[model samples]
Target: MEVSKRFEQAINKLYNAFHNDTLHPECCKQCAVGNILDGKDSWKHLSDNHGATTLNYLGQVHQNLGRTFNGYSPIELLHIEATFLKGCGYIIPLHHKNKRPKHVTDKDVLFLGLTAVVSYLCELDKRHDVMDCTTLFNYCNVIKQVSLLS
Candidate 1:
């Protein structure tokens, strides 16, 4: 049940953001990767578009160098951002007229993003999603816990 320091810190920040009303899908500094990186918006420079999964030239250079921000590679950060935005109901590569949640202030929308981000994080670490209810089945011996790389 060991988790990497990076994963633990990222989960804690994400949990706090969800509870503190600070998880905003559109804001570079308040988004999933932002909070994961301790509220820094510099990661936005890694991509041309906010919700784009592809990296820009700078991002490619960093990735090639094996540079990591808050323990996440540049490409992982992009995927995390894209996951959050999509979960929050934004069309990919966000634009002013992009389809989005009707109510940006809705907590439900943010919750969706949080869940998606958590799943991604767990997968990144090759661990079972801690929030998954299927673990209850494992306890009952009805099925195995869905751990990653099992």
Candidate 2:
């Protein structure tokens, strides 16, 4: 489907970071929103704590002002970060006290996070999931139909 220019850019950046070992859930500069914003850490100021989905005073002001970072509202950015961290197997409001993946930098671990991020992005954009396996299921259904016909 057709994607917005911002979505295209963000996906490309995220893809590169994922393959280059630069995507880290614990790091603002390397997190999902950060990568989408071209590795900028300024988005961290939107929330009081890392992995938080709620906006702080500054974030609320920006949201009220209709401010968007790289085409995403402050609320959307917070959701993206929280979704990413959750996909990476971390509890909300990231902390040393919260449960997290044993190996933060593992390729497999990052991939899981990316998958979740992509799904959320699609949902946000009102597009089909790029990583969906429903088509495979449909194919299997087709094969079953053929077998039944045979």
Candidate 3:
């Protein structure tokens, strides 16, 4: 049930960079130009652009990620993460259209739940304009620590 440190680091760094502060210039942009460019690239291609150094950039990179507090919503980031996970082959496809199926195993559910928590945090980053870095770091750290307990 424990989430890997790598996973926690990846999600927290990304979430904080996008929401808590515009630390990464490559990751964050001040205009839609970057997002438009990102949208043009496949998710796999875009993810390659992420790195620790990406967080230390000059200009705001959150804007480059297509997050605008005035126009965008947090839920959209969840959708984006879900789509990315799907692209990464983490989420299995549901067969039935209407009624829910019991095909997903417990492990799958737990994995999804953890991913959802990270995704929700990312969404929160998109909605708010200004947030304390400590708050965001603590939130991510708490969930990551809890994952270790599992």
Off by over 4 Å in 3: 23-150
Top candidate when judged by lDDT against the true structure? 2
Model 1 lDDT at residue 114: 84
Q: Global lDDT of each model? A: 0.90, 0.92, 0.36
Off by over 4 Å in 2: 139-150
lDDT, candidate 3, 71-132, per-residue tens:
33223332444333342334322222423214322334324433444555444454432323
In the order shown, what is each candidate's alpha-carbon RMSD? 5.3, 3.2, 15.3
TM-score of 1: 0.88
- Lowest lDDT sum, 10 consecutive residues, model 2, at 1-10
- Candidate 3, residue 64: the lDDT equals 58
Please tell me which model should have the higher TM-score, number 1 or number 2: 2
Model 2, CA-based lDDT: 0.92
Q: Which is the better candidate, 1 or 2, if ranked by lDDT?
A: 2
Model 3, CA-based lDDT: 0.36
Deviating ranges (above 4 Å) for candidate 1: 135-150
Best by TM-score: 2
Worst ten in a row by lDDT for model 3: 50-59
lDDT of 1 by residue, 29-91 (tens): 899998999889999999999999999999999999999998999999999999989989899
